[model samples]
Target: MSYLVLARKYRPRNFGEMVGQEHVVQALTNALTQQRLHHAYLFTGTRGVGKTTVSRILAKSLNCQGADGSGGITATPCGVCQACTEIDAGRFVDYTELDAASNRGVDEVQGLLEQAVYKPVQGRFKVFMIDEVHMLTNTAFNAMLKTLEEPPEYLKFVLATTDPQKVPVTVLSRCLQFNLRPMAPETVHEHLVRVLGTEQVPAEPGALRLLARAARGSMRDALSLTDQAIAYGNGTLAEAGVRQMLGSADRGHVHRLVEALAQGDGRTVVETVEAMRDAGLSAASTLEEMTAVLQAMAVLQAVPARAAQQDAGDPDAQEAARLAALMPADETQLLYSMCLHGRAELGLAPDEYAALTMVLLRLLAFKPAAEDGATEKKTLLNPAPPAEARPPAPAPVARAEPPAVVVAPQLPEPPAPAPMPAPLAAELPPPTSAAPAVQAAGQRLPVVDAPRRPAAPTAPA
Candidate 1:
């Protein structure tokens, strides 16, 4: 009849099919296996992270009859059973899916609660699944409070919200809450590869990786982007086509930008930005791509053995490793910080490409002063004060040391000259007594003559 999107086609039907959220799955599976069923459940997380999916699976597990029609409460539901199939197709009589975002008034909530008084018609329990429950009004939340807190034994409440903080505590306390975490990049990557294989699509590994990273931990988003990438590549996904589709610069360009920054080459940085602008690529995406490379380079720099074993055949890896060697650890940290803060300023700038260019050049401005080939290298930050800041202190210190040695020999020489000049005032030259005149100022005006004559008589006596 109609083409099914990959997101819906590959939706997780059971807890076992769920990826990247084992802790929640384990707890729910054990609870179901032990028959410890809660009347109400709350699933909270960001959008596209399977809040609705888990709610449906739990609904099926509660109601599924086996293929032979005898199954009761199970963690895994047999998809062929009428109960499971209906739940999967959203046609089950007992399961009610509400979009609280659209119907958030008290009237809508009161209407849903009105049905809780009745028992299940086609399943073991009647499930009320409200997606984006946080969007409901305060009065709406108040209307559901009494019924949600103490619902009929046959009724189950499944509340899902992306923003749990907005959910009222009175309603929250009545249900068992589980938070679904975002998927890891590796997990998303592997899942994309599996999907492409099933579709008979020949996608390059690099293309899948770009999709995985671009997905930012959303499997549905990843699959959606993959569909677009496939179309962009004309049903054959290649790295070049995917890169163009995402408007990302070549990995080679990212490498060159980082390599130039590490080498403090401003011209290369400017030219690279120019090339990206000319190619009509996004400035933010270019910075985003460089951020990824800089992160990897930091990782490589942290682990040298890993750097040595980088994929020799891959040009991107080779360039990254080469940059890892060229950039010291501190500068790597600096460049990483610059890229992070620069991305935020792009919108405020008049020309985003000019902002991107300035961002790339910022690394050169912050280049570690130690990297400069100087015998006395100064740090770019925390520079030393000028040597003459304390001019008086050092001047005295330098001059005070030499006079100590000069004074020792001169102390004995001066006394001998003083007595000799007095004893031989008549035989010796007047200059012999001149040395005492230099010291006579403290004693008297004529002490040079007066004291030497008196000292000459006292010495003989």
Candidate 2:
């Protein structure tokens, strides 16, 4: 037999086999048992979250016959029946899957609708499963609106799309919508363990953990990566090999970087980046790992009790708790923000490693004053002076003004200028009352005009 990739080979055979989608499964199961079926169903979520899988299981439930070929519709399908077996193999005539991404025109939609008029040939109900239904054009969507809103009792519609926003609201209104969320990393990890156990492949827990994190909540992606990791490791999965394949930085380097950052040690930070570069590690991955570690540190700092509850076996958690105590909460938050945003900066620089170095150094450049030995500088620059040496602050004066008018006090005229001394007066010419006043020695007196001078001048003219 040819080789089968883990993703396809381990595809969920039924709803019971599905993981991390209990909410969706429970609702569908109850609905199936109660026979409360909608004419059209819309499954929305990110890629590889089992939107199509749920649809297939639902189709099987509606068409399943018993092992003895005497069964009616059921929540659990008998996999042995022709209808269930054919649907699983994708060869069932009644279960038709259309890849809307390729055939997204009105013609294709109309052609599919033409099949709707006919009843099921080999199953209880005719299922039309359209994958990536969001890719269908507006005209195609409009053409199917009427049929989708009110389809025949024997016909069923199952639409799956990664982007539900693009799926027209008109179609959305007619169908029952269920949003399948991405699986948690822990869920993906546990599922990987089970799948690998069944495959009889030996994998380290750390390797599986790395793969789960790299999968980013996609089980299909997790399985696919496991297959690659197994191949890369020559039949067994190891943390070092998986990390190398994913280009993920070592946790040791990440912890060292965080510890260096917490200590405000720029030299250690630079040396760590150099070691990472020498090892051919990705700068982006380093920042990504740093962000993760920093986030945990921040959480631990905020909730000190979380440290006790964290996985005791996980060295990363213990290291994070140690660093969390070493760094202040505010600095932890600042570094987390920087590392989170620094991933985008890696691509903008000419050399990604150089950019990574700058990003790491940025935390030191903006280190908190208390941590950077600036607290003393702040105190020295703004020290309080002695009371006597300090200039007193000016008191605030209240301003009030009198009316705009002035009056001078009256005084009796000085007693006729107190008659000059007789001897000094005699030395001076006789003074005219209006003009002349005697002065003391070395002081000059005003001159008085002689009365006859004007007459003498007039006679000469």
Candidate 2: give its CA RMSD in angstroms. Answer: 7.9
Cα-based lDDT at residue 369, candidate 2: 59
Query: Which residue pairs in model 2 clash with each other?
Result: none
lDDT (Cα, 0-100) at 69 in candidate 2? 93
Q: Which stretches of model 1 miss by more than 4 angstroms?
A: 305-318, 369-372, 375-377, 380-461
TM-score of each: 0.81, 0.83
Q: Which one is best on lDDT?
A: 2
Misplaced by over 4 Å in model 2 are 369-461
| TM-score of model 1 (CA atoms) | 0.81
Poorest 10 consecutive residues of model 1 by lDDT?
403-412
Q: Write the per-residue lDDT of candidate 1 for residues 1-461, one digit (tens) a residue.
A: 99788999999999888999899999999999999989999999877788999999999999988889988999989988988999998999999999999999999998988888888888999999999999999999999988888888888899999889999889889999999998888899889888889999999888988898888878889999988887888899999899889988788888888888877789888898888888999988888888888888889888878866765755667777778888888888888888899999899999999899888888787665553555233455866578887355544344444332212112234444444454466765345444442333234333234233333445454
Backbone clashes in model 2: 0
TM match of model 2 to true structure: 0.83
Q: In candidate 2, what are the lDDT values of residues 80-100, reduced to their tens digit?
A: 899888888999999999999
